[model samples]
Target: MSERIITPRNRGFLFLDAHPAGCTRLVNDMWRSVAARPAEVLGEDAPVALVIGSSSGYGLAATVAGLARAGIRGVGVSFEKAPTERRTGTAGWYRTAATAELAEQAGREMHFLNGDAFSDAMKDQVADLIEERFGRLDHLIYSVAAPRRTDPETGVTYASALKPIGATARTQTLVFDEDGKPDVREVSTEPADEDEIAQTVAVMGGTDWERWVSHLAGRGLLAQGFSTAALSYIGSPLTADIYRQGTIGAAKAHLERTARTLDARLGELCGGRAVTSVNGAAVTQSSTAIPGIALYTGLLRGVLGGDMVSPVDQLSELWDQLTGVRPLETDEEGRVRLDTWELTDKVQDAVAERWQAATTETITDLADLDWFRGSVRQLYGFSVPGVDYSASVETDVAWPASR
Candidate 1:
């Protein structure tokens, strides 16, 4: 192993390296949190699940909870860069490795496939693995967050653009100085042109999800009571122009519609079900890139405080919904609403007030910049407690094989 002292390196919001020890710590925390919940008796037959994009954010949290809390055997697929002798791997790589190690200690059957989830070859490999080992798929979680996707059949690539639909969106957002100090600044995002909007939808929309389910069905891999969930987010008016009513929103709209169509098809296919889970805002790698999300989430953290539901908490509840431990709660459109806490009138009113009052001078007072900063660090395996940043670490960490 090539060992070296590693610290956080970043270019604006993009992180350059990840610490394996810190990634292990983050996964351990997630495991402990799930273990703290009252234990469930998953009898002799436990569900087999497949989680696409199961390396970070909601997907990673769901994998942790599903194995540690819900007692499920599963497969997780993600695309991450493996570490070289001179470079550290992506955070998701370390996180996936750590999660696999912990799952092994817990005596769980967790397999991992590291490749593009949108590719036909990847889907075929997963389907074959399920057929040979697991027999059937009980649950499917689609949580992919990608910038671009190449259509396997058409040989064309689509790149997602994060911009408004009809008009330019202007807002006071968060920016970091060279020293990594946070400050409020105004940023304007131009609207996406027609091609960009279509491309965004192509990359981020539900067509890929539909393809996955369809492929699994063709393979006769869906179980009697199979269920699928695609993670989605709907921010409030503060960031709606760049979020809920934006290019990403158009993709999300298609995702939700696909869920409806899938729900109807699955209802007939095996008494199965499908729904889009609208998760609450939290510190995620994807969220930090959006135009106004940093300011909005910072204000949200300030206002919600103890009431905030983490990705782990929300995904644990999602497991509960899937396993029949509790009733599945959904809105009129049949979408699961996990953002209720963030959207409550009491919370939004306070957040909106702060959003309007926020400026560079008052940003510290108006938002939880500290929490946001720390959370973003935790995403890339930095700022984690008990990890010695000064110590030499193995840059070439091996990803554990499927068990």
Candidate 2:
């Protein structure tokens, strides 16, 4: 198989290709980055951890990075489907395999489970697997982002559709043109109904987190003083209507509440704890699909000079919080406020200013473009190495196990 060079263009979607070696290189780089800057506080060595939504995006990368940095050997359970030859496993799946392979090479124990995380059978399987293998869990990370969920009580499967809040919401988006500036265009979307909002909350929100925590707690599988965390995001006000205030916002609110409840329950169990980390807006397979986030991220990237932190960096911070080395800011509700730092008041103010000033005549600059490009590149196996981009590439590269 010949390697190919993958680059991002203005098609407005994530360009994906399977590059196992590139994925492995990312894992290696992440390990080096974390080891060079070890956290001041550290958790017990080789503590067990379980990551749901463990196959892609921030969740997958975070799981790999956290395990490598903390020197913890644990089981990873994700609902990632197997990858096709023409395309990479979802970013998370590739990263999971890459991380596990690297960890094994480093003399660390690791395991991967592929299945639906929201299923009761899968949950029981995970608990049983832990009991049969490691006996206890020290950390739990919930990274799943399903758009719809089945109602356990009603036995109805509800899927969510994304749209604006009111009659219609108009927003500016950065559309790349051949000319350097981002073309600002007004975009509008319809509003979702009350049932849709509720369903969205049920699916994408924190109920799964609570279920996992409760399941582990009830089964006595959670270790004493363990730490559990879930990822959340609060973008600028531009996206608040659809994201922070709309269906997703409602879901996040539920998740935030779930975090607090889990924290108290876990505290009672092992003196353990539960936390939620609000992450910055980075290009993920998921985040890109959101209406105005791409423009906001692109604009923020332009403003910030494209030096945004990668999933590995965020994961390091998450690990630091989990191990009690660094203190995480929490609201009255008790969720770790990482997003506030990622999208600082200064940054938000600047973005808002740019958004207001944005017009078709004036687009974003190269600095912002760089940020967007960097994130987009990282989503696929680009920017990481051992990939020979000069040659024609095969999109359908099969995994070793499947092959």
Candidate 3:
């Protein structure tokens, strides 16, 4: 195949194509970041992890961190489109390929399953793999973020809504102007109906996480100290009405409840643990789509500057907790709060002050628009420091491991 330059094709927050080299660079950078940190030696008893939705964002970060920092090797499950001769693949596809390459370099065994993670067939396949390859499962990381899900049992598909719960929600959002600059815009959404709330919970809630644990336990594949973590978020006041208090918030609350139930269930079965890992806000593919998250994260980046904790940083901490290098810090509800810095009173006060004064004219000054743009672009494999976007490259790159 002839190498060709691949530039990003995007509209504001939605990207249509991904650069393979850019994605490869991103995976390498994440590996180097986690490798630089001090990690406890797990040696022969290293955990076997299964990272569902492990192609992008925190899932990908955790996969890389587990392998680079703790020598964890296991399987990952994600649903992504493969690249062909005429077009590019999804960003997650390229990212998984790059991660597989890194794992090979480090003498770690990493397998991948590219298909619907919400189906019974995928779960059964993973169970078979565990029995055949790893013998037992140590860690299961659930970081799935999809717009819709079809129940494997009933085949009923539920789509998640991002609207508020009771009253209408009005907030400031971010959009790109004609000059390709970030500008503040106002957005309002009506409250979601009861059905919408239920659907959102069905798709994004912890029911599936519980199902996976139950399935594994039924198959008797859990290790002596098996652990599971499901990723979640609780935004600040700026996005609380549309996020933490909205339809998705109801889903997250359900996820937390499931965690408590599973915590006890796992203890009885395998002396295991279960918890919701509430990650901090960052510019991810999922976050960029939420109504007010773009503006909120931009302002957050501006205020926190160098003190902000990144996805990889949080994943590193998760590895410590999973391996007994550090204790799991929890809120009153037993959910891990990784958004501590963002929720601090000082940070919230500064953000609120700036939020009130923010407008098109003051957007550049009030928020880290440049950083926001760079981060969004980076998610789809663009805006990296040394990548030559104008240079020729191949788009139909194959994932290192078979699906």
Candidate maximizing lDDT = 1
Candidate 1 similarity to native, TM-score: 0.98
- The estimated TM-scores of all candidates read 0.98, 0.86, 0.97
Global lDDT scores for all candidate models = 0.90, 0.71, 0.89
Candidate 2 lDDT tens digits, 129-247: 78887899989888887766665546778787676555576676665555434566877878888877877877888877888888877898888898888888877887887688777
Supply candidate 3's per-residue lDDT for 123. Answer: 92
Task: Provide backbone clash counts, one per model.
Answer: 0, 11, 3
Any idea what lDDT model 2 has? 0.71
> What digit string (tens of lDDT, one per residue) describes model 3 on residues 105-171?
8777789889998999999999999888888999999999999999999999999999999999999
Stretches of candidate 2 above 4 Å error? 1-11, 36-45, 85-88, 151-155, 176-182, 327-329, 383-386, 392-403
- Residue 171 of model 1 has an lDDT of 82
Error at 196, model 1, angstroms: 1.0
Instruction: Quote the lDDT for 277 in model 3.
Output: 93
RMSD of 2: 3.6
